[model samples]
Target: MIFLRNILFYPAFYLGSVFFVLASVVSIPIGPAPLRWSVAAWSRFHRTCLRWLLGIKIEVEGQLSREPVFYAVRHESFFEAIDAPAMYDTPVTFAKHELSIIPGWGRAAKAYGMIFVERDQGAKALRKMVSAAREYSQEGRPLVIYPEGTRTPHGEAGKLQAGFAGLYKLIGLPVVPVAVNSGPMYHRFWKRPGTITYRIGETIPPGLPRAEIEARVIAAINALN
Candidate 1:
């Protein structure tokens, strides 16, 4: 049953994504809000599909802060990335710089307020990221970053990427580490029926030493492991 459902869902998901991407492109002239709405709508559609078609449910633990802060989320699968808009209001997600080079989707992401990071540029990239983060933080938008940089298999706790610590220090906002175990369930073609929980850990205030902040974030985000 799950296999059959997945077979039916894959095409629908891709088709729906293409439709929304085009919607985002058309909304470009309308402004960033409309483009963001299009993306959020896509997220909502996927969440609804997951519940109804795949029998997968979401269970969030702990409170999400209303104050603008850096959200250091564990990277488990693409599921958590798409689920961001559904979970937060106008989140500024940190994405790879390469994603911004894509044709229509890239333009939409920039207009919709994603922060692109040039990882290989070292110091220059860090400065750019800090500037972008500060701007968004001032605008009362929560910044979401996958500290592991890329998706890791479920139950694995990889080292936090180099950029996370720098962003934590320079952004000057509290860090909210979020652990999720969605990979085992949603990473595969045939997703299993279960609850994918976003376990929000305690908020670590800014201004802590580098060692302290890194330790706290790593431990907190890997709590589920």
Candidate 2:
């Protein structure tokens, strides 16, 4: 049954994404608002497919903050990444430098106001990401980042990446640590039919010394694990 559902989902997800990708690409020439709208629509399309087609639903633990702030999220699957746009008002997401070079998608993401981090460039990349994030915050857009830097298996605790602490300190926004158990239901080729819950932890104030803030964030984001 799961295999049959996946067979239905892969085609719909990939082929549908192509249309949105083209829409996003075309909107680039028009301007930022249209480009962002195209991308957000694409994200919602993914969520709708996940829920109705695959029988996977998302449930929230705490109130999702609408105020422009930094959201430090758990990394379990690509589910949360897609869910960001569906849940926010055009969030500013942190993405890998590699994704920003992928032909049509790259051009669209760059113009859509994402902060690209060249993980290999070390400190230079951090500086660039911080600068971009600050600009987005000033525009009252919510910024989202996976503190562990990449996906991890469900129920496992992954170490917070160094860049996460750097971005949190430099972005200067109160961080809302979010824990999402997405792997159990959303990861793998054959996804399971279940609920992926996202727990929003208490907001941590900015400027609390590095050690204190990092510890708090780690604990909060790992609360579900």
Off by over 4 Å in 1: none
- Residue pairs that clash (backbone atoms under 3 angstroms), model 1: none
Candidate 1 lDDT over residue span 1-225, tens digit each = 888778767878778888998999999999877888999999998998888778889999999999998999988888988899998888999988989988888988888889998878999989988998899889999999998898888788798887788788788899999988888789876788788988999999999988898889889888877
lDDT tens per residue, model 2, 1-225: 888889988999889999999999999889888899999999999988888889999888998777888999998888887888887788999978888888798888888988888988988878888888888888899999988888989778888887777787787899999988889888887898998888999998888888888888889888887
lDDT of 2: 0.87
Deviation in Å, model 2, residue 118 alpha carbon? 0.5
Which pairs clash (backbone N, Cα, C closer than 3 Å) in model 2? none
lDDT of each: 0.88, 0.87
TM-score list, all predictions: 0.96, 0.96
Worst 10 residues of 1 by lDDT: 5-14
Displacement of residue 3 (Cα, Å) in model 2 is 1.0
C-alpha lDDT (0 to 100) for residue 2 of candidate 2: 86
Each candidate's clash count: 0, 0
**Angstrom error at residue 16, model 2:** 0.4
